[model samples]
Every structure is written in structure tokens, then in C-alpha cells.
Target: MICIMLVVAVVTTPGTSMASVKMEPLARTAPPPVEFKIQGSFDPSNSYLDQGTATISDNGNQTVKISVITEAKSSVASIGGTVYLQKWTGTQWINVGSASTISASNDWYFSGEVVKPAEQGYYFRARVVHWINHNGVYEQGETTSDSRLVS
Candidate 1:
């Protein structure tokens, strides 16, 4: 004669379930609307100069064209300035090339332009030191253009 025995075991967490559970959705709100106001018009007669403009453009062939225009309130003995081509070197701006021009006689405005070869993958801008000579005294102002990249 022979004898045999059998045994079984089961385990589970105290406060957990084996089935999936759904979560509540989060709430989202939109921001408030914004408003803007306009002020008065500009008056140019109160200033010593009327306008000073500078610009820089890419020529699509590793070159750039820079230009500047300066206007004074009244005609002077002379009006002119130097146009500078500046390059961005990651830290600061440095002059690459420059050209200067003055009116042949008394004039109210002056303009100049220059074309310079630029390096590929670099930035450039135009800077002008505008000046006017009345009688014997000289008044000077400065203007800078928007930067452009050469491809």
C-alpha cells in the first residue's frame, strides 16, 4: 500500500486591482485679450536734422551693397559722410570697407553707396557718420542699417 499529498498557494496586494481605471480630464482656459493705443503725430521741425537712413543688401554672389542718405534741416556749406561696411565676428562688429562722399557745393542732403565682396555665411551692415558744415562749424550724427547675411 502507498499514500500521496497535494498543496496550493495564492497571493495579492491589500488595496490594488488587476483591471484598468479611467482618470478625469484636466481643465484648460484661454488668456485675456490685448489692447493698443496710438499717440500724436511726429514733428520734424524741432530737430537739427530731418532724416538719416542706411541700408545693406546681398547681391547673391558673395557680395553686398551698402548705402546711406542724410538730410539736414536747412542747406549748409557742405553735407556728406562716410559709409562703412561692417561685419559681425560673433562677438563684435568690425569695419570691412568704407567710402566717403561730400557735395560739390552747398546742399541740403548727401548720399553715397559702396559695393564690397563679402564672405559666405557671414553677416554685414552699413554704418554712416553724417555731418553738415554751416559757415565754419560742423555738426555730426550717426546711423546704422539692418544686418543681412551673405549666401
Candidate 2:
């Protein structure tokens, strides 16, 4: 479970007018998310799915930013997987157009933007598949992230 703590303290002068404020991350801890589950077919060496995260931001003109962080075990890459960005309809989850191929490397971070309905609430999530070794015996490990609502 990834835990993030952000604390910002703003001090202003009596006669000064502040136009902008910049705040850096106070404390950030990235533990394996509780929602990520590994299937039995996956190898133990690449089982842990750490730093799986998703977020959406509005940039006006009906544009929404979607981001996902796929890291396993340590900060470096430990597995290869396919990261999918999906959107939930009223009844079912549908795959969006954006799909990222995460090759085994040191930490994989993917971000994309889509034009969605403005001011309408929708659920979004990331689905990742950890591809086992490329040897003759290959097994796939899969996991889905908890949904986040974006309006």
C-alpha cells in the first residue's frame, strides 16, 4: 500500500502579494498496494507488484490526464508487463485507446491524456500483466488496480 503525506505551510508578509506558491513533497512512501493481487501462475521471483498507481487530472477542453506507475520489488524493473488504461462505463469496464507495453527495465512509468466528457464523473483504472520469463515455459501474472473517480 503506497502511503503519501503532503504538508505545505505558507507564510505571507503583511504587505506582500503572493502570485504563486511552490510546495515540494514532504514525505512519500511507496509500499505495495493492497489491491494488487497475483495469480498462482506467476513466478515468485516477479510476483510482487509494487508502486501501482493511477490518477486523472483536468486540463480543460475536456482533456483528462491518466498516469500509471508499475514497479516491482525494488525501484528497478523486475518484471515485464502490459499496462492498460481502462474506463468504467455505467455497467462495465471498457478499454481505452491507450495501451503501454512495459518492458523489463528499471521502474516503468506511463502517462497519457484522453478527451473525455467534461464535468461527468467516471471511473478509471489500470490493468497490468506481468509476463514471466521468455523461456519455453512462460506464465502470465495479472493484477488490476482500485478504481478512481474522475469528474
lDDT by residue for model 1 over 2-51, one digit each (tens)? 77766754344666554533332221212112224222112344244456
Residue 149 shift from truth in candidate 2, angstroms: 1.0
Instruction: Tell me the spans in candidate 1 whose CA falls farther than 4 Å from its real position.
Output: 1-48, 102-104
Report lDDT (Cα) of residue 46, candidate 1: 27
Clashes of each: 0, 2
Best candidate (score: TM-score): 1
Model 1 local distance difference test score: 0.66
Of candidate 2, the 10-residue stretch with the lowest lDDT total is: 23-32
Against the true structure, whose lDDT is highest?
Answer: 1
> 80 in model 1: Cα distance from truth in Å?
1.6
RMSD of every candidate to native, in Å, equals 20.7, 12.8
What C-alpha lDDT, on a 0 to 100 scale, does residue 11 get in candidate 1?
47
